[model samples]
Target: MLQSSDYDPLTAAMRPPPGETQEQREEREAAEAEALEVSNRIDAEIKASKQAMKRQKKPIRVLVLGQSMSGKTTTIKNFQMIYAQKSWAEERSSWHIVICFNLVRNVNTIADTLNEETTDSILTGRRSSLTEWHRSVLFRLSPLRRIENDLKAFLGAGSSESVEIHHPNRPNTSDGLRDSPSAQQISPPEDAKRPQEFCIWSSSGWKSILNQVKTRSAQGKESQVPRMVRAVLNSCKDDIHLLWNDPVVQSLLRAKHGRLEETPGFFLNDVDRILSTDYTPGDEDIVRARLRTTGVQEYRFTLDKGTGTSRDWVMYDVATAWIPYFPDITALIFLAPVSSFNERLMENPRINRLEDTFVLWKTVCSSKILANVQLILFMNKTDILRRKLEHGYQVKDHIPEFGGNKNEFSSVLEWFRRVFRKLFTDNNSSLNRKFIAHFTNVIDTKATQHTLQAGKFSTSRSESMALRYGCFKVQAAILRNDIEEAGLM
Candidate 1:
């Protein structure tokens, strides 16, 4: 160990000459004090400004995209829920709005992860929905707040006593005005809660007074206080309605509106219950039960819970939003059914002429997309093929070992992978090395079966499975690599 007295290279180099003058040393010390004071002040102000900026800045925007029923909604729902829960714990303020349109309800087909047979009636913009009032309430809140001060100012109040419009409007009245007979009769009781619940005027009284006014008007007599009060209330209601109809307020309302509904536990409970029912339920029974349950319209319920977290997704169908603004879309989640490609590659005329029909892929590869485009192929309905392989007969004698029913599992996977790889290469690497293809049979027993049969669904699976898995794995790894290089997470 080195002693403190032992010469240190850094200290020696920084040391001043022993013969330095007293005046020079005094000047140096004064300069050093001034420099330290300046640095300290700068640091204090910088810290204060940083804290202030953090409070003022907006939350980061994240955009998500996936094909219809490809777990897109469920993904977003899960994300929103998780964001609320975790972000709440982290003390971070975050909010989300989901826009769903053109949904078809009550189909007889098997559903994906986050689909419901019917969306909430309010979300569908239909009257008679129980949640209609709730929908209106949410839409009203944001715009009301934005124009709260304006409304209060319009109603003859200054900024000091102005309340948020969502709160009850309390009119300022002096003690003399409160004691007046006309005012006491017209003003509501103190115990009344909301403006709507408290009747400002008696309907029967108003009717009688209005009749009196009409009768007097017919006789050429002036109308009284009752007629004037009636006119004032009607004018106020019309003003409120006009505020709701304002174009800027309406646009802001649309930007802030969202719909949420609870999911039924039928599928979650019954599926788990069925799994635990007997010591030995056959694979066929399992498959049939899944098909039956999946055919139910509860697919939408999952979007709100398990897979719902990914709903930050904005479908670019409406360019009126921010979709057109961000020219660099980093990734794309493409939806193409594995069954469609397998069963209809030759039969579907549109697909048969792939060069003519694959306009979306070509567009994605164009200069606009190529700068940042990354493709994720969601191979839907893989469960259908897995079931066929499990139950469908294999080629009999004289077939190679790779053609066996068990090997067909690998073979089927290979078939899809090869096709996707070929398509990628044929299209001049639209995704370049960033192309990833994966199979998803969300409602089927196949994913579990593939996991069980293939012993973890990794090494023993086809090159295609690897390629698909590689997409996510590689992206994640690249992120980690960047983080490591930056000495972050």
Candidate 2:
């Protein structure tokens, strides 16, 4: 070992002269500080290298793909509600306007459906006729046309001027009144701007309409609107139950072959509750609100627990077109609406909606982009499917291959499962990729939460014996099923 004084001669040689000036000492001290800083920077570089390795292991990036109205966006919303809750309250405030518009649109539909009614006792009571009430409501609501149009434009309908109307009620409660950031209302432009979205503010015409309502209410003015018309909006649960159950409306719906009965969110059902000046959509209403997915949108939230310790969750809500080609995908969540079996595609009425969904699934499954990625199929809208069963809908009538032997939920579900499995088995390059399936209501947050907890890692985790065991079982079942059907098992 070196002695403590071994460096004394070298130290003396480096020291300043006996009468060294203050400037010389200052320069020495500065040099020491510079050396120390260099040492610290070297330590920092070592630390940064380690952190870079961790960041290179990026969090799971899930892709949510489906045809329009396949619940992709709703799934993203649920993810936010479950995870990034600090912001959901703020975002939900913007939906108050949307809920109001839904109510008005439903009432308008009913009125249009029954405009020819003249002698129906249910509609023409001594109080007032339903047609007359519809006319009065439409007359009073003429001012809202601009507001509705603007709201639609903002929701990605088309590039149009956003109309902002005076919000009559600014409730102090925490429900949202904020608008989506995608679009905003602006004053008339002198020069053309990038046409994207529209917004509406408190214009004079809108304010005047609310003022008339307040004045009339203050004076207890006699109203031409029927008490039943008021009931259609006034009694939240009971009134709409009555309206839909009305014998006259039922007769008219059957005569026209309209699908009002088969659908949910009859906004008429929640009219009065949603229309009341105090109306603010609750969490459930926001979940249930029917907004069509228009374009490729993304939602991100930090999961408390999922896939891995990264806690970061990113899911893309994509429609049929303009989907990004992401090479590093962790999972692909493909959705098909099971209840849409008997419906027609909104965009192409000539095609069956279920058939459209099958085409979409096949296309997505066959894509080379997702060849190695895991597959998760969600047979969404179980609640609607159950209701359709209770309503005595025969699946074979709509899907003839389903065979008339069985018309229940289980049989129909199995048929769909087999259809998807056959698609996968037929196209598999080596049958190495696994196809996982779930019956999802999607709207039920608890059910979806459970699915996330169970299948959370199904997409991101590396192959393991246990997971491969599950995959083998899935494949074995499919093989056994095929053999049984072929009478060769």
Candidate 3:
């Protein structure tokens, strides 16, 4: 009986005046419609807000992929130099080891060549044991041994390091492998101090190499002496420079047919200043420095979004079929070296480097996995190509295509541009994708810095474009979530 009175349908707040006019009723209905419209707009805005949160949570990831020595790593280094300098400084020590190695290996090669010529049984060509000269040259190059030893110790190779390596006894030595040294223990002094903290500049390792590498024979001061060991002859540069110039050295180079002059990373032609006692690697030196990226490496940095706004960015240094692919790839930056048009692969001397780039480009462009992903092609190493053309190196000599084409740099560069542009255009008509490319001398910071800015702008545009397409999907997802929550089929 109390409940019937307590629950009143016609309460004071809900009451409308009796004998209300038709105009008032119409106005009341319009007000209710306005409220419903406002409610719908709020619900739409809430759904939009959640979708925006999802977009903001997902980071933009760019991948740098290319063959070995095609300037892929240099492009990444350029990005680091522009965005992250502190990280670059910390990793500079590793380069010192590479520089030292080049010098020692070249001298040993020279000494071996000299000893072989003296034997002149070059007929049997029976591998020379040649212990006497090997030991002599090994002892001569002992000063640089400290840096190598430190590298091994730092890399956790564990003592059992050797000084005098019998090249034949080296385990896992790859043919034509100029970079790796085998561990054949020669007599290292007992109870030596542990490697003094991986700092080559402060360590006496550099000083010893400079002191020990003097050539007794300097018949003439002509050039072409240092060409053979140009890749590894940075340490003890002065002695090696003269030694390389020596007639005997040149004679050995001519006999071996070692054409070190044309190749990139032949720093023996220039970059001597970095060998000095107090030298630090300059931006250019680091770019030109011969450190092949062996595996995938991730680099992260904070992007300058705007005043009072910023975001974190990540980039991956990726690989190819010869190298593995990056599973974390979001966007692709493919570097095609223009200079490689006339060059052969270090891995397979039979195949042209540019040909390999074309195969890689096709693989990346046609991949179903990356069908809708952003793709940017970087036509890198333009500066080196310019030098090659000016110095009279003809492309036709190496590549049979473009028979009798004008040998001028611009004309030749245009030809390559057409080749790349036509490749994606003709093969994948259904994709209907426009190919974008940039001419970059990647080692040049100014060029790559501009290129990166453009790349970022293009990337953001692509992400927004993707967002437009993802809008419907996101709305459907929200509706599904609501249905599940309500237990509705």
lDDT of 3 at 156: 30
lDDT of 2 by residue, 13-75 (tens): 877779878998998889989999999999999999998887664655667777555666566
Which of candidates 1 and 2 is the stronger one according to lDDT?
A: 2
The TM-score of candidate 2 is 0.63
For each candidate, the alpha-carbon lDDT, in order, equals 0.32, 0.52, 0.50
Q: Which rank order by lDDT, best down to worst?
A: 2, 3, 1
Give lDDT: candidate 3, residue 343: 51
Worst 10 residues of 2 by lDDT: 174-183
Error of 3 at 15 (Å): 42
Tens-digit per-residue lDDT, 1-489, candidate 3: 558869777685556668989999888879879999999999999999999887663444667677666666566555555445455565554455445444344454555566556586556766544445444544555554454444333323232211211111112212221111211112223532121212222122222222222211133432232222233344456565655666656655544533443333345544366455566656665655543323356666554422122444466666555223545445567878777665544333444567667766777777766665556677776777888688787777666665699999889888888777766665543364446565655344443343343322222333211111111112112222222232322
TM-score of 1: 0.32
lDDT of 2: 0.52
Task: State the TM-score for model 3.
Answer: 0.56
Candidate 3 off by > 4 Å: 1-57, 89-121, 124-139, 142-238, 245-272, 304-309, 322-328, 429-432, 445-489
TM-score rank order: 2, 3, 1
The C-alpha stretches of model 1 lying farther than 4 A from their native spots are 1-66, 78-324, 342-359, 388-409, 428-432, 443-489
* lDDT for residue 370 in candidate 2, whole number 0-100: 70
